[model samples]
Target: MGGKSSAPQVVLADDNSPTPSLPPSTSDDPTTSTASQQTTSTEPSAQLRPSDRTENLATDRTSNPSSSVQNENAAPVHTNQLQLPQGTQSSRRRRREASPANSREAQDRPSFDSLGPQGETTDEPLPKRRRRDHMMRLEGDNSNTNGGPRPFTNGSAADNLTSKSLNGLSKAVPAVNGSETINGHAKKTDAESSAYFGHDREEVSRLLIQALSDLGYSSSADALVQESGYDLESPTVAAFRNAVLQGEWADAELLLFGDRDGSEDEGTGKNNGQGLVLAEGAQKNDMRFWLRQQKFLELLEARDTGRALMVLRTELTPVYQNVHKLHFLSSLIMCPSTEELMIKAEWDGAHGQSRHILLSELSKCLSPSLMVPEHRLAVLLDQVKQSRIANCLYHNTEVSSSLYSDHRCDRENFPLEVAAELHQHTSEIWFIAFSHDGTRLVSCGAEGTALIWDMQTLQVIHTLSHTLPEHTQGVCFASWSPDDSMLITCSMDRYARLWDTETGQILRQLSRFEEPVSSCAWAPDGQSFVTGCLYKERNLCQWNLNGEMVYDWGRPHRIQAIALSNDGSLLVATDTENHLHVYNFTTRELEYEMDFKVRLTSVSFTKDSNYILISKIDGEIRLFSIENRKSIRTFAGQKPGKFVIRSVFGGADESFVISGSDDGYVFIWHKENGSIVEKLEGHRPGCCNSVSWNPKNPRMFATAGDDQRVRIWCNQTASAPVLHRRHRSTLSGPGPV
Candidate 1:
């Protein structure tokens, strides 16, 4: 609004016309000769070059009102006044061929300096009546007569002129500084023409868009021009500009190769990064332009129009508009055609921007039929931002640990969603165990392999498999010795093997097991271990480090879960019969019995042994006061009638418990009241079988399911997970820890 150049204007004119005429030419056609010689003067016509004389004749004839009318009437179609419709190749070609004679005539003329009434001067030949008409129309003016001024308001004409002239110039010549010369000659070094018609970033974008859209790379071009300020000189600006207007970014990319040049490789990345290099010394402030171009390039690579527009508004538009352009951008982003992942990534990445500011704007623009994930993410993002303490915790009682909290969970109270998950199992992980220091984790799966993972990096350090082919059917469970130096893996082959974790070598194998062992645990002193069988009558058995079974709590119902106290004096077990039995390791006597409302699938005790977390068949997790053998709290919000809780683990602090459900979610609950503290999503297509929190960091955890992938998540913010490792853990390392 502040710049006069930005405004468009047209002057009202009368019917009167008094422009001068030129002398006739000598060598051209009758009409050309007549038009060219109108500028003849007493000043030595002999001293002038032929081309110079011809240029003078053409300009002078165009300047003559009567000659201008004659010329316009004589020509079959005035190329100067032509406008080509978009995508009409035949019409544009016709216009190009039609103007050759006029262009040749203008080329022959010598440069002349003449002043118009309003301090406007031209060294090159001025446009004839038809050319003037074309220019007027290009500037959005069409009612003017031959050689007469048209009336229009300020701002309108200037703005239109600025936008369209740059747009036109870009279409005509895409090369840097290509249009700087006019009429076959360069203007004087100090001429104001250069400054008046100079191309800026907006102009460049406009040109880029025009070229891209014309060639069918409309999508890429659209991304380029959107939200960019009115700079036309930036090399790729116009291509990008036309793209945004047309919503044809993909087409813009195709345009560079002549509009779907090849039929076979359509929409492939083969032609990506085409012609992006700028020549040396192209422009002084090219870095800024390059960065702007780079942004569009990224959009092209990402194929994300919304993100590109967001970048343009937040970073590029402010340079011209002085105000943030995000309001306009949000509308474009909320368009239905955009992908949900791209939109969520944008909002998640822009957390520093106020949620109210971002969401309110989005709500106004977004449709009611928005994709479910985007809607959920938007709502969750807003809720998280509004809350004050949004920490998420997952507890693992086995190692007395909790995963890291979500860094972005800034809420008034803890959010009921787990922002992170960690899963690193290659095969069917039957058991998982955290090392003594909680710095490492070990897991055994059906592949007969044991993996050691560095808890801090969440990466696999070692993979162990028995060298002897005699062993088969795969390992079911693993437990790390209290000293953290040894790992024991139990397999369905009725064998328990001790391994040196540092070297991944088998140290000893105990083959005394009777049936397929489903679960195992290591005593705190590392002197003995326990194993439970899948059969209903195999009895929970305790074994010494040397491989001798000592306490065989004879066949009860199928033993499903087993655990030992820190002191090794108490061993607890649960069976398929929904009963819990406590055995005194020192006395070798069954001392206690307890019953639950439902068949308990699993059981985990808190680090202090004061509480236990039990997962039931009906999608419920019950926390119990272990010492008193009474139910403390129940966590029961599994999706109605369809999903059930699979497993539960008591965490380090005794304040949190982690549970896996059939609804593809891993939930963390406050152990004291069973209030859900967090819900971890991302496995929307698969049912989760198990979940475990990292002992070292309460905020990191793992989830495995029918998706055939294990995902490790590190909670970063309530808006989104910080790190999402999918399938990577399974391909590389430790089973599930």
Candidate 2:
């Protein structure tokens, strides 16, 4: 369906006609003269005009009236009012050719060519235009002049800028200050601030989950495991743990060994459910013995003496080779009642309930990856809290939560308050020492009595005194041998005696020295010991286990304190003349000697034997590198003088130094930096003669003082504000000048 359209009409103007003549221009300017002559001829110029279609297109583009027009043969024109494509001439060229010299438009017109390529007639300078286009690309604006997409150089530039700004703002903000402040409120430099806090989230979560499950908070632990996405506990192990908790001994054993068959006899070793098939040879034997032993204990608790005897004779007796453990179990069989059995076995509870503790202990035999620890989260948290208390310097409160983790503890758990204030000693207790096993504690006092305490009961088990045919004067120091079977005590009467810990009898008496033995230390090997005298002769002597003197070194000044290294390779001794000497004990040669202005009260070597710690009368404790012969660090705050204030390295890695002060306070300092961690207050207003950290229990330590009481310091339950007592003497005197 097409309709014929009429042909468009076209009109043409004559181009060869004579132009009208005009008067000559009077202007002297060549530009004006040339323009006037061109207009006077009255003939049409050769310059081309836009076609009617182009004029119509320009008119229709009224919204963007300044847009450049495209011509067929010439470059696109650019003007102050319109932007054009690159390689185009300015619109000034068209205006100058179209207007007469004598007209007002001609007088105002400018020639762009004469002004060079950087002409004022252009929309913008070439450099500025290029910069604007570049910024647009960075902003992700890809549209071009022709309404087409253009490629971008950096699409993420804006995002990068935003991130940098946010980072700068976060760093500019100051950290909070006050009680909630951490890291000791110490200002950190840029380098320190940039350090990464290398915390493993998965490992922490796993430990927390294990801790929670062990503490009987199964629901909480389950919830945590679900939220943390950490599947640390296996269903098999969970079933085994549940069986143990429910007192299903046989079922628990089957789960541990992955043996579901329960066809084995109860007491015969012929079939014991294959006994943890995955366990190694030695470990499997140990596990089988432990499991059978536990079964025997359960039978005895149930009053099935017949079955218990069968288990002891056939199952347990054949595999359980530990003589002491076998004897203990055999003795349990003779208990007249469950109460007697519980008492003899040291059970925490009665009968069935007590079996839980046994089962818990046996659980330790399993690999940690296979079973949750028998200890509760609360207990493990208590240990962590206690460790922080022991390691922290300047800790003022009676109890504190761990600064590194969420573990918390009270005094009852570790014993911040005196659990048992020993009044057995008639005079001030001079020294207190815990046996290596932590089962017994020995305290010597000015009353010439040495009391041995049962740590479990906190009761005096034995009262060793001059009445026992030992020393005539008060005992000055006491130390337990490495084996914890024997004890050595030195007295003001100039004798050092070795005593049998179990029988509370004197084994042997050391030969009398010219002066009182002020200090004594047991060698790590347990076969030898060292002693320092207080006055005349000033002898440092090494004695054998039988109390026979083996080696002796004479000194001009009285020995104030002495220590034997853990390996027994080095001996450190401080004298009254403020001199510290280190000796290679095996070679019997002096390694180094250091002199101080103030008298050195005590000296001890680090566990590694690389450094020596010296306590001075000037209220200072100094750490010196043995090889470098230079002071590594200095600790202050405790008022030391007029008494031998022994400072000891303690904590998990010997990371802290604990010492007693004359102001009746116990001070703990960080060994590396010498920062005061905690200042404990429990003793009465006098000197805390000595402080001893329990070798077996890092959380438990004892401080004896002039208060005539041995105060057991542990983690207190209450977070009571520690009463910080300022020693006026410490402030008034010059410390180490």
Candidate 3:
């Protein structure tokens, strides 16, 4: 090992004594004198790590062996040394009533903590629990046999220290005046090296190491940390991390709040930015309470009720913070066994470091410079890939991004070629959608019927049972429940009906809408459905599964199409006058509004529910960022003159925008740039009214049109493209087109 600070070391103590006594105070009682002198020191004492504390204890004892003995009549000295059992502790009384501050100090400060292995104070604090910071920081004595940096070896925790990053990379080569000589030639130092593209070599190396480790290339990460002499964290931080994950609670508390004073602990300080911040007095007490609570709960789970009780009165109750939590923890004391205690406290017992998801939450307050932020490099790389995809006009692949090259997807990756056509609808097909699970397709048309087709079999599974006459009351649109168990269908006949998706049995028919019920959408909870219509009264009416109206949001906007955000937070309704009304679903309040001059065809939210995509009769699709409340990007290049041509977000990450056109073609555009990528022609000349993209299968889509056909399209270049099938056309007389 390169640094003893990373490992717990227990020096063999003498038979009769422990550590030396502190310098004698003028007062007879050391506790009284120590309490009075608190905060008198101009600077905070440099708090010791667990290993440092152990070493100090040993050093004190070897310096003055006679100080180990205790005098029964003398004052109880300030000590973190080994303690006698509860039966053996002195019952000496205080000379005078202690002031609140002295009492608080006595309560908060660490006293007889048995932080070592084997429940012995002098045995070494959690022996052999090395720090992750040391291994990553490249500054500590590494224990790896290969002489390379490793991550959380033996399940040890990360050190939350900011290593001397500035000097780490330069260690690779000795440079004078920023240049080093190699083979009688001058070379730029690592900091000035062109290989890293002008970025700090140390930063690049550290991030690379982190990325490698997260990507499961621990061997490669270690090699880089060793070869570059750059580590991911500092020693003190590493020790603190090790202590917490190893259940050495007091040790972590010391590193975080210092010895009774909330001051920044000293260690590696070469980080360029301000590191972890010390919270104010109240916050410090709160944080201390948090750590103590975890320690207390774990003690109860360990069946160490004696220690757990001591923690409750001394460490926890004295802090005067989170009284409710303190009361709750106190209630757990009644549990008779470890299992009962765990159940009552709702504690995740120490399962290595995982039990205390405590470390991760605690680390958030720490500076990334001190502790390597979790998955730092992976997060950055993902952001980069997303940025490239957002800027790329033709990026359309599910293939993972490679660091070797900038990301770009071939145009053929997008599903463009028509795979199969269904001639089930006899009139103009208006609305088509895939179920939430993508296992079936639901289509409605002027034929006055809605058909549910199993995608796997490509056959109509449930021709919706409705009593309307053919071509008289066209089914406008349909929505599937979150579970795909039931569906709601809106028709031009001023009614919307709920039906069982499996058997096509009518569950209920809502007759509230005086005008045609144009569009319907299901709540994410599958408990309610929202209907939009041409509007005789109000345009938006929410109805529960019991067939009763839940809420009739006021306003008489003639809505043509509507969609609820998958998250159930937002409800977007598009009106005939080209207006967009966005409502807060839970609050039933209008959040905002946006308008376009041309009539709106349909409205939908992005998969993430952050953006609203509204297709218009002007042959353009506009993307409005919900937060920004305005159009961020508008996609054009489609013809939607006569009929409502619905466009939708599709492809990986919703990277592509697709719509069916009046000219019997399916137009696909790069959602980022509105650049037309493909205009797929197959349907007999007429409007391709609606399109639905498969959520599960990114390379598949279905489109319906006036040609009385529902066409299934898939990426022709992709392997196993839609299992091509031959079926009877059923186009006895070219019904719609």
Candidate 4:
């Protein structure tokens, strides 16, 4: 026993005591119950043994255990003594040593059995509050667990469990500030509001009264119900009921007067009581009859009338009148389509229902176009019913069905975006002309090809590709004679060829233009034509339809384009300079010459022959009155780059002017006002060369652009009608003609 007593005894002393289960700690320890609760989800406790706590307490001597321990018999310690001195290292060490044990005890011990029965052993489950706190602290300490020995977030079961629990808890909480529940405020929907305010007396009454104006009800209804100190409900409801139930006015006065508190004098002159009684009486008398009559008209409008008695029955009693009024109301209630009205009338005749009488009453106001003509009533009856009949009746001729049917013919409508688009083609489409009557449209591009299409159908009738022995190069300038009977085409081969429209056979070929003919124009009479060369000063060469070079407006200032007026007297030619020359074809002398500030590309007389529309190199259009030769309006809508005006033309009445620009927009404009009407934007990246209006329909026209696509526009309706692809022919291929 003495030898055993001499052996060393290890005493484990925890100077910084572990937390007690029965009560929460009030110490300044990091693992203090409150801090432990806050940090539990984000950080875990670093567990240390009691021996380590003692060693830490030894180093932190300032954390006096004697002062911290609260004995049951001892008095309270001062608050200053509880506070650690100015956060010293000893105080920190004492806190670290006891923190894990304090948190662990609080989390592990349960409320009921935390302090065991002997006040010695603790076997209780952790306190729910402490356990929750500890779990939170462990949330952020993902690295605390090492591999199997250390728990990986995804690899270990414990870590995965923690993640799942935390995720579930997060989902249970709502988003902080979302639209549906903005800052926790509940929202209301349109459906909910509608449910609370459905159609009722107030709503229905408003709707009925407003329908009067919308449905063409006469102002008499409003006038009779004027502020006569009478409630609108009794009169309105009474009026409707009388017209619906009783078909006569004998009771209308009585019903209207029954509710009156003021005008009750029985002996008062019958017509002296503000005339309302009489007016109401009058309305009551024929309203049902009129409503029934209205129904007949409605039948006429719908063109259907089901089998029913069309005659009015009168038995001099208030009840009969009300019934008649109800009959009238029924017509309105059963209103059908116009066709059905006629059917209803026919059916009524078959059913032995005074179809003749119904037609007679309705025919007084309705026209034969809508209602049968046999129903004409007597003059007196017609006069008596005029007001009521006029209010409800309409003739088929009076209303319109003027909207044309699609079968007639459909053309594309191109609403222009700018004033005009000019130079409609770059190097592709070379020849463009309107037929003599301006009906058939024709275009010939670089591939020796020519296409003729019906302007209305936009369907190509012929695509002529002629193989000629001598006329080999692809044609450039092609023009239709005034009669449209002959077409003359010229090319870079310095040769002009004329073709007979009926046979497609070459009439003749004149190889006289020293340079390539760049442009051609036929004289007003189909007898001769003129051609212009690009570089030669002697630009114009005249040849008869038989390919005879009969006349020459020799070397006209390096002419680029030429146009002849309807009269063979005037020919306007554009030279390389800013000047335009007008020549007297008969006199062979210049009539007038106008100088332009910018290079002029193309020019044409307005449809009325009142003004000249000129296209310039800068992509601008200027309107000049032929009489004054002075500019009237200038239209510019070219994109921000160097561009040329390819072509210019005017609608028949000079209402619209169209110009093609290098930027690929066909600008349509109001000729007089110079206001942009619409822009036909269709061509890809190329100059729009020429545009011509359909002489028959001003709304229809054709445009040729460098994109090798000739598009047609019948733009009378849409804002910007789509371009109908009329013809797409390649320019690089061998000449078709």
Top candidate (TM-score): 3
lDDT of 2: 0.58
Residues 368-472, candidate 1, lDDT per residue (tens digit)? 211011234335445763331223333322231122443332222333333334444445554455665768767666667777876545567888874357666
Task: Tell me the tens digit of each residue's lDDT in model 3 across 60-172.
Answer: 43443244553322332332232211010001100111122332333443323323333234433322433323223222222222221211221111111111122233222
The candidate that achieves the highest lDDT relative to the unseen native structure = 3
Candidate 4 segments whose C-alpha is farther than 4 A from its true place: 1-427, 456-459, 464-474, 640-644, 715-737
lDDT of 1: 0.47
TM-score of each: 0.40, 0.44, 0.61, 0.39
Tens-place lDDT digits, model 4, residues 426-488: 347755667858677777766666666655344555555543576646666677777777777
Please give the clash total of every predicted structure, in order: 102, 18, 14, 83
* Alpha carbon deviation, residue 29, candidate 4 (Å): 99
Q: Output the lDDT of residue 722, model 2.
A: 16
Model 2 regions lying over 4 Å from their true place: 1-415, 467-472, 535-538, 717-737
Worst 10 residues of 1 by lDDT: 87-96
Two-way lDDT contest, 3 vs 4, winner: 3
Q: Judged by lDDT against the true structure, how good is candidate 3?
A: 0.64
Order candidates by TM-score, high to low.
3, 2, 1, 4
* Candidate 1 ranges beyond 4 A from true positions: 1-426, 466-474, 536-538, 639-652, 717-737
CA lDDT scores, all candidates in order = 0.47, 0.58, 0.64, 0.46
Please state the error at residue 206 of candidate 4 in Å: 52
